[model samples]
Target: MKNVGVDGSTTLKVYESRGGYVAARKALAMDTNAVVEEVKKANLRGRGGAGFPAGVKWGFLPKDRTTTLLCVNADESEPPTFCNRVLMEHDPHQLIEGTIIAAYATRSQVAYIYMRGEFHEQFHVLQKAIDEAYEAGYLGKKVLGTDYALECYIHRGAGAYVCGEETGLIESLEGKRGQPRIKPPFPAIEGLFRRPTVVNNVETLSCLPHIMERGADWFTGIGPPHSAGPKLFCVSGPVNKPGCYEAAMDITVRELIERDDMGGGMLSGRKVKAVFPGGLSMGVLTVDELDMKMDFEDPRNYSLLGLGTAAAVVVDDATDIRLVLRNVARFYGTESCGQCTQCREGTSWMQRIAQRIESGAGRMEDLDLLLETARNMGMMPGLSICGLSDGATYPIETIVKKFRPELEAAIRSQPAGQVEAVLQAAN
Candidate 1:
């Protein structure tokens, strides 16, 4: 965020003037194991919704493998989440430099940045930065004058939200359908053409250069011990100043919404009705639950699927909760790869039921049915290939459970014809 909005920040020359690539150069000179160990001590968690420790994930690779690949997941697919694009457009070199260091540390001979097809502008900017790094000997054979050879390329995804899953990304990279595979032989063991692979998102990789430049202990000291470090948060939906922000994980959901420098409070001074605290997938936080911390662990306490992407979408009292439920349900239904029957039918069923409820054609029993369907959708034992269906579950489950009265009232009062006026007033 420091380089954001600065003139020529995306250019190699300007980035070099600010001592960019210093960490990559330093990392190139250190032992690979040492680099991994330093990151482990930093407690840096993946920013790609999972919040898994990046260093621990790296250590999962087999020691005997000769060829390893590092993938940068630039597919920012979570709804209303575009913070990853901010780093790509404003400070691409930081992400590129971090990619170089991460690939080297993971002993990856090749690296690919899996970008979403929608990111036309970010793709060009990041590609330009990669070209500059290659010309500077910071990438390609003999990185930074060291013996470490790394080849990094940008691979464009065909707009599949499920590709945000690592296995799905790998399958797409292999020229196959973008769908996730089962675990046990995770990406660390058999990934990307059946070789050991590491997949970290743009924000997670971007933290690598910083960890290399500054000691790991410095990162560990930032926030909570388990989920420490600088965090990028995007606040949206009717906030006075909705935008991408960077801060330590110590910030609360309420602060992220009401902070003058961040969200600047809700628009038109409306009270907050609810918030999708961690994108649409993690779960919803009612107005009374706004005090929840944005760290990776706290969301779990509130039945969220972890601090997913740290992108918070606020819902003011003016909006209807059923609309949110229907929208997300429809999204997961449309986006599900139809790989798993439960996920495929489950998302569609939830979407249809939500639409019915919103249209005032729902029965009283429909609320409980929605809850049951969502609870068992993606989390069934040995059923779901990935957590995509689970993503659909949390938002629907939370909204129905936490705000049942609101949804129930809408169901009973909305007489199908009144649905039009509700939509019109919202618009």
Candidate 2:
């Protein structure tokens, strides 16, 4: 990422000089099935929170379909997930080349980079790169003198967090409100413009160039089995040096936070209290659990939602988990699309309960009520339209469950009259 500075590295000449676009050219020359097979063998999973195998997703496209579309999800709206944005800013050509390779593999004729509208700087950077690619025969009809042709465009989103959801992104791209559509007819079957579409994250696509250049075996050998390859993790919050760092997936959560070259340990000379191994969607892990690996499966072992976006948010010992819960609850509550009653109403309730608790007005039963509300709004189908509500539930549920004693102590310390006023205010 340092290669990108005020001097600029956003041109085709700088990119090609660094052996860029070669992978896209090579991919364009191979059979589409061959490219897809390589990616599948490499086991590249989506980095956009879902952890779905990218190659497997591509394989789901109906072979009979004529207009397969590839949508590069550049909407990095999730809190503390600047990994995608960083990649796009530092290496726009890498993403562009990967987009072309993915489009070729999916037999997609048209590609759209569904970018977050708030990323005005990145939008212009990518736009300049795309124009350079087109002028140099890397995009547009007959790319690189081959009969294969592809058209790419950028569609900016209106800064909706729901748009980070693939289906929601598709809707936004189609000039509709950013709301997730019901599944069963997944994006691979019916997506943007009602055509077969494959939505992939910017980081996921950015890996394609290196995967093609070095071969699938090399890619698979980078980390532990099932979670191979290098991953970009955005480490933020209370750390001496919180930023994006790329490492093998096998790196433990502790290493990522304490390593001098990574997060550089906690600020204020404080000890670690907890860490969100993934982004906000994943539940927080106590300092004792820091030894846990930062893989797709390890998070499940810690009883967290899957490694969603692998952006580790660290909290120092001085921080209160109640404040954490309240902050997260407010984020989800504000971002809820209101398409589902359970999510809309449940998130609001969770926010109120968390705020009340943080405000020293929590009742003893409020903890049970919080857990009950989370259970009711679980990620299970028929509960919510999308995973937003489920993401909202993780922090509140996990924090309350894991740190009940601390919360209980806080509640007990509040004056009885103050607590009564809180109840009256709610009523």
Candidate 3:
């Protein structure tokens, strides 16, 4: 619940002075099962898009498992989602401590922070924090004079968006291309050098310290049932304030954008055309749906995919919807690892269609084709390798679905006499 790095609290000495590693000490003293149970009671969901229960994820590891690895997913490459980056740069020790607690709960001795390579400053900040932790006996050989031991290391990713996926991250950590692996043996049972591994988001791990300190009941009581604990939201686009803000999961999208403490409303007094309520993958929401709650159950009410990373990228009335769609298409298209032909091919096609549509070269049937293509890419009928395709599918599908009228209007309004001008501009 506390923001550590906002006021120059990055140093180990500062972190320790504010009772940073106390939870690790507490976790080390308790039985690992007890720690896991406490986290389960807190109802802390993963902050990394999926929102899976972190405690449940920890429970997936087999009892008495040897050579387990805990990987902290610091690959904050998702567009407009900079909450993790802010946390890492400002309070590196918090993540380090959280990593230690997670490793202890999972009974793992070796932990890796899979950070994005572009986070050059945050990478060094975390590395120095790890070094400080090691020097202070908070990490390495024996954590805080306890028998529990953990060696935390920083594994820099090559800025591949696929590496944000756990298996892909594990593969890249092993010096392979950042493509996802087929699941049957989920990462908890088989991962990271073919041994048991547990991957958790940086924010997910960061929540442990608070959960351990405040107790599960306290943490769970903070938000609505399932959506318990404080959530960090990254709000970008044409807002008066574009930054990471924290609030309970029950907060509505309108409040997040309109509240003075949050986004402080849209800039230039423009009406919102659509908002990617929880980053791009969650799909776009109309201005009328701004009152929708951001909780897991509430998003479905507004026809959203789900709460993905809880990062909102607002698009105001002045911005073109096609441009937004094209941008989303381009990101997924460029990031697809090509492991599955469905995602690899579908994303490219979506990009082409979206670009063509945006450039006034689209036909009336293009919308249906785009929707059909997105649907096919979303679910592979066992052909798709990972969620990348699905991730790519939702935004395009939802944007097209929700803003059909706008797109249609744009197409109809295209000047027939300016075909050459349009073509030249597109080129």
Compare the candidates by lDDT and give the number of the best one.
Answer: 1
lDDT of each: 0.90, 0.89, 0.88
- Model 3 spans > 4 angstroms off: 417-427
Number of the predicted model whose TM-score against the real structure is largest: 2
Which residue pairs show collisions in model 1? none
List, residue by residue over 78-182, the lDDT tens digit for candidate 3: 787999998998888888888888998898989989999899888888888889899999998889998777888899998799999999999999999988889
Q: Spell out the clash pairs found in candidate 2.
A: none
**Stretches of model 2 off by over 4 angstroms after superposition:** 1-7
Worst lDDT window (10 residues) for model 2?
A: 1-10
Estimate the overall C-alpha local distance difference test score of candidate 1: 0.90
- Candidate 3 similarity to native, TM-score: 0.96
